[model samples]
Target chain A: MNIRQKVSLLLILLSIMLALLPLTANRSFSEKPSKLLAEVLGADVSVTVDEVAEFIVREDPDVRLIDLRPADVFIKEAIPGAVNVPYSEFIRSDPDTWISNREVRTIFYSTGNSEADYALVYARGMGYNNCYIMAGGITEWVRTVLDTKFSGGRITARENALFETRRRAGEMYTEYSSLPDSLKAKFLESKKFSAKKLDGGCE
Target chain B: MKFLRQYPFVLIVFLLMVVLVLFRSFGGNNFRYDAARWAESSVKGSNLLTVDQLSAMTGAVLVLNLGDEADLPGQLRPKTVIMRPESITGKENLRLIRKHRGPVILFSDDASTSARVWMILSEMGMRDVYILRDPGAVAE
Candidate 1:
């Protein structure tokens, strides 16, 4: 066959193969299952609630806390600097929109441990290595950080420092949780705008 | 032969596409289920099995313990296979999971570990796999 005829035949064959294949537009886990599993199971994938509290007290700019509870629940009470990206919404949308900043350590938490762990796995499966979970979730935060007390005992310098961090973090949590709905809404809106700006969006 | 000589570029492109398609089709160890489908099932809570539900299952159930063997409940001891969460996707472990005829349940002392392991296994398209809803129940 001539060059034109041969080229046409090849093009037709390619088109047929493409048409017959069950191609999907959705993204799948790119990393091998074994490698991803090991990474997810690693100790570094989880941060204690105390560490999170310290982050809050320090106002660490490099850390981002993600609350994976419903919007209404999040509005009622959340970690001082946490942004609400409810678990349902988080899994439904592209994670990149929320965790695009690779330089920022994104920590996920829910009322309990399950959702945060699920998000960590999902994020890591999609190759977002910066993602981590707040071990024991918000429940542990309430237990250890918010409920901390001096109890009239002699404290070491290290213990005193930890108590101070927890106290400050708890106070910040209470203050943020106590804000009026209108003010809270405004604060959240501003935070969202800042996050967008950080993500390089003009809007 | 003349067509091959004149249109080598087109032939090369066609061959490359075919090889790529074949490689993607049968060679890679990528996830079988898409992210959306896995997310949907997870949201619906179909991937979780409570302790009560686990106790009710009659058939041969393979319990893959991703925690200490001592932490596993007495009832599950007979059918439990101790496994490390990190090594769950290892060749032998994966082969055993694939060969198991009954439902494979993942158990860990930490609920988060179980949850994370469950997602990884599910995305790999392993069927009839579940995570114990509360790992604490194993201690009970």
Candidate 2:
């Protein structure tokens, strides 16, 4: 065969192979088998609002909150110290950078439960047993921690203690959210992430 | 350039096939867009009650506390009833809900619990069921 004929044959063969690649192995998109779904759903992979609140209040080093909300919402308001990894981005990107530490309790949250539930299931399906969902999402944090109130004549020491804790947490949430734009900007400026330059032995 | 001119059809077909393969492999499912759009618009506040609105409702409002008793707020308005979400299935709580002809406001320590409760009550065909917005911030 002439040079042009040989080149054309190679190109055609390569194109055909590429076109058939997706179909060669299992390719149909479907939810995991029922047993896998059951295992994920039945697992104790949920963290309560109170637990998350305590983590934020105490600034626990071992707890990491992952907000799965959109970037716009996250940029406007998010839990303090929480990182935004929107569900789409989480699904597309490598999670190692965000969730590599086995010791850190990575709690995923969205505006509500469903998105976080999906993220939890996805993570668990990928063998990430250390992942957890923040039950009820950020909305729950607002209602349970911020809007709590005592009423009627009933008063108990334990209840009082709980209320005080909620009160403190609520104040923290309010104080953070109510900060002036300039002050928040300054704080954000201080928190800006600067990439580290790598010094290596590459020659 | 000579090869392209001589084999335009083959080149175009090869490029198209390559593009298709790359897209099928790298382009994520449309499900991502649907899920994101669903999430962005899912938290509807149509049935939400703000502090001012609740205060204005006066006798018509019945606040149901669906969280732990320990975390009750410092001062809840009158006609407030405390009960776990599971307790809602009981005849007593159902009766209390039915007794209130006006709005039955659901609240918890967090918006998440209240939202879940709101969904349950909403699905139960209850009318005038509203969730309490966070008092610290204005209702969105």
Candidate 3:
């Protein structure tokens, strides 16, 4: 066989092999298993409920809280400023659509920790290193941040600051959660529209 | 020989592609199941098995305890292997999991840990793997 003929045959063989492989063209983990595991199990992968409260009070633009609960439950109540990305939808759909900005820190929280932890692993496995979990989910938030009370005779400056943040955050949560369904729907719609505008998308 | 001499660049590129394909084919790091499939099973709650359900099963079940020894129940002690969540992807651990014939169950005191470990194992293409759910735990 001619050299040209051999090269052509090799090219055709490689193409055929590539075509036959069960390639997951979308939604497969890109990170090495060990590395992703290490990151997920690391100490820095979770933030305390107090820290999330502080974020809410300060209106931190760099942080995005994701509520991984059912849509109806989210509409009833959620952490102030948290956007609902139901766990099932988050897993089924392309995560890039929900967690588009790599610069922002995305924190996942469910009613408990299971869904959030799953999301953290899935996102990090897909090469989104900016993901984290709110340690002890919304249940913990309700326990620590929402029901916070002062029993001490005298409060230190640091204690005062912490309580202040929690109080403000709790107030915001109550106000948002207590809104009527129609108003809540409008608020969510407005937030969605603003988010689209920020993304440079048209109506 | 003539082709190598005449078209070194093309031959080199072809060789590089061949190496990549081989590496990917043999690489243990790649995910076996797609995200959609994992999501389907997860949403359906088919990947979770409670302790009561596990007790009823009459098969050779391999339980992987990803938490403290004290956390594991008394009945599951015989066939259980205590493993750290982070080491699950290690060469030896992967081999042990792959070699096991029966269904493999992952348990942890923290439900999140089990959930995360289950997804990782599922993505690696391991079948018949399940998370041992606590009866008291609330479903998300």
Q: Give the TM-score of each candidate.
A: 0.86, 0.49, 0.84
- lDDT by residue (B66-135, candidate 1, tens digit) is 8887776678789999988888778888889988998999888878788888888888777688988877
Give per-model CA RMSD: 4.1, 14.5, 4.9
* Model 1, TM vs. native: 0.86
Instruction: Sort every candidate by TM-score, greatest first.
Output: 1, 3, 2
- Report the Cα lDDT for residue B59, model 2: 58
Candidate 3 per-residue lDDT over residues B1-140, each given as its tens digit: 67455666556767888788776655676774466665457767799898778888887999998887755557767998999888999989999998899899988877778888888888777768998888334222
* DockQ of each two-chain model: 0.56, 0.04, 0.44
Which stretches in model 2 have alpha-carbon errors above 4 Å? A1-19, A23-35, A181-203, B1-140
Error of 2 at A159 (Å): 2.2
Winner by TM-score: 1
Could you tell me the TM-score of candidate 2?
0.49
Identify the runs in model 3 with alpha carbons over 4 angstroms from their true place.
A1-25, A193-203, B1-26, B135-140
Q: How many residue pairs of model 1 clash at the backbone?
A: 0
Q: Rate the local accuracy (lDDT) of all candidates.
A: 0.84, 0.64, 0.83
Candidate 2 per-residue lDDT, tens place, A65-161, comes to 8888887677677777777777776654445556767888889999877567656655554456678888888889888988889887988998887
Question: Residue A112 of model 2: what lDDT?
Answer: 76
lDDT value, residue B121 of candidate 2: 44
**Could you give the CAPRI-style class of model 1?**
medium
Write down the DockQ of candidate 1: 0.56
Of models 1 and 3, which has the larger DockQ?
1
